[model samples]
Target: MKTKLVLNFNPEASNLPITHNLIAEYGLLVNILRAEIDEIGGKMVIEVSGDDDSTNKGVEYLKKAGVGVRPFKEGVRRNDEICTHCGVCVSICPTSALILDHETRKVTFVEEKCVACGVCIDACPPRAMEILI
Candidate 1:
């Protein structure tokens, strides 16, 4: 199973080798989408791929390690009024969530496919894609 998680690390938990343990011990593939940390602690957006049991175990492990785990629901949002549909975000979207409609020559934002990487936010010529998370 593939799970998208938002991890909150406290000051003590931030000092641990959490990612290394998740990969070596739980055997899960971890892809960090976005992260912000400091001496006090911070948050990270990560995508984990593994079997159902392993994924569940990984979450439990994070919880036991004093890290708060939550699902990632917020994603990129496009403001149609501001968007010019120039398709500038098409090539930059890592998940292909932003695409250009060949026939209509318009840009489309697929929220379900977006990983909230925030790449499109800066790549957008009109600044249409905004990361709410």
Candidate 2:
């Protein structure tokens, strides 16, 4: 079985000290999927994959560190009407979770490869991709 996890960082919870401690403690192999800093806030998306135990452990570690998480299902499509298909998200996706289908030419989102970093959402100019619970 495969599980897709998504972590939504709250603007109020942006604390590097706690983030660093959690990463160090849990050995979270985080790869920066996307990062942006502006007047609004700082955002970063990361993808993490491992065995079931490791993945669950990572979730637990994040929860303890006060991060928000949601499990995403595979084959779940967001509002395509709002999707722009600009390919900006495809280029910024760190784990290759979002892809452009060669046959259909539509954006394909694969949950199995998602690290829950939420970068595609930020990269999305139209804000179409949604975090499904």
Candidate 3:
């Protein structure tokens, strides 16, 4: 099974090798989708793939280690009515979740690629991007 999570790390938790431990100790495939962290505190979105039991245990371990974890089904959504296809979000998206169709000259939101990092939410002029979780 695969699970996507948003993790909030405090100052002390930031120093820990949480990702490494999740992979090495829990035997899971860890993919860091988006991360903006500093010595203080920050947030990260990660996707982990493993068996149901391992995934659950790994999440439990994160909580025990002082990491705030929130699981979500989907990340971001775009309102087609509001989006102007300005391409501002297309350039700023780290994951290329927002794509500019050259032929249509329109911007499209590919939800599957979104990590809910929220960069496009602010960059969007129309305020079309909404965070689901």
Candidate 4:
């Protein structure tokens, strides 16, 4: 099974080799989708693939290590009604999930490619983008 998680790190947790331990100690594949952590602390988005037991244990290990872990239930959602097709989000999307259709001059959201990074949510002028998790 594959699971997506959002990790909140404090200064102490930031210093730890969390991802290394998650892979080496827990026997899981860790793919970091987005990471903003620095010396102080920040958030990270990661996807882990493994058996259910391993995944659960990895989550427990993270929590025990003083890192906050939350399941990323869903990616970003766009409110079509509120969207102006202004294409503000298109330029900022890291995964190219939001695209501007040149012919129609409208923005298109390709949900499959989104990593739920929340960049588009902030850039949207109409406040049409939101993260479901």
Candidate models: Cα lDDT each:
0.88, 0.62, 0.88, 0.88
lDDT tens digits, residue span 82-133, model 3: 9888899888888898899999998878887888888888888889889865
- Number of the top candidate by TM-score? 1
Query: Which whole-number lDDT from 0 to 100 does residue 96 have in model 4?
Result: 96
TM-score per candidate, in order?
Answer: 0.83, 0.46, 0.77, 0.75
**Model 4 superposed RMSD (Cα):** 3.1
RMSD (Cα, Å) of model 1: 2.1
Candidate 1 Cα outliers beyond 4 Å, as residue runs? none
TM-score of 3: 0.77
Encode model 2's per-residue lDDT on 12-42: one tens digit a residue. 5565453464357655565554454555445
Residue ranges of candidate 2 with Cα displaced over 4 Å: 1-4, 17-23, 36-44, 72-133
Query: Count of backbone clashes for each model?
Result: 0, 3, 0, 0
Off by over 4 Å in 3: 38-40, 91-94, 100-106, 117-123, 130-133
